[model samples]
Target: MELPKVGSIGEYIRQQRQQAKISLRQLAAQAGVSNPYLSQVERGLRKPSAEILNQIAKGLHISAQALYVQAGLIEDREPDSDVLAAIRADVTITERQRQVLIDIYESFRKENRAGNPEAQPTQPAEPPPDAAVHRENTATPDSKEG
Candidate 1:
């Protein structure tokens, strides 16, 4: 699927909402915004704040980073690994989990680049020990435990 161009966050949001088979009223209610406000946003008449965007992302059951990227709030990076792309595209995992994985992956890339500026970017970063307690008690949000 072709992504909406950057700065066209409204179009992107609308597309995602439609793709999810949600109506405008349903999305507005799910997103916790007024229907008129959401309509304005979709029509490009109003720009949504980060908080609103976050709520919309949650309502869409998608990674907030995806919205942020389309909103131009996050700088879109291109990595050759395809791992980052897959991570973002994965709908099975919770948004928080996706973010943690992305953070770890980017950190690894940064470290690698720092150590060898000429080295090509590669390797999917593994979750840190702290990120994995493997215990029910330490579960993060959306985890079975919490």
Candidate 2:
């Protein structure tokens, strides 16, 4: 797939922030960035780092992977289903929750693929070691969210 122009990332970020009804200053604050820097980034005067993009994604209540795709840090690919897209696009869920849902979805997919050898691998998706910890932790009310 063709990637978006580098300059469009700024526009994407600005658009997401606006859609969230956040002012420039408020978004900057939420992203733990300086207002001037974020303003520069929004206007395409400055390129933001990946870390900044992640923070901006968090502040905008959007997907970091989506932002990464827009920024060309990652290749864009169609999701397997609307359910996956909806999970990524959901604004009400926390990032951790989104990840958990995705993990479960991926596990199901792996189970299906294992049953049928004809299914091709799209990528080498390795679950993080801490994913098990997350599953275990979620079962306990006292577990602190990272």
Candidate lDDT scores, in order, read 0.80, 0.79
Per-residue accuracy of model 1 over 1-146 as CA lDDT, tens digit each: 65342356787778778778899999999999999998878877777888999999988887787888767788757846699878866655655687899899888878787887665666799888689555456656777743
| C-alpha RMSD between model 2 and the true structure | 14.8
Clashes of each: 0, 0
Native-vs-model 2 lDDT?
0.79
Stretches of candidate 2 off by over 4 Å are 1-6, 79-146
lDDT for model 1 comes to: 0.80
TM agreement with the true structure for every prediction: 0.52, 0.52
Candidate 2, run of 10 with poorest lDDT: 133-142
Question: How many times do residue backbones clash in model 2?
Answer: 0
Residues 12-52, model 2: lDDT tens digits? 78777776779999999999999999988888777889999
What's every prediction's RMSD, in angstroms? 13.2, 14.8
> What's the TM for model 1?
0.52
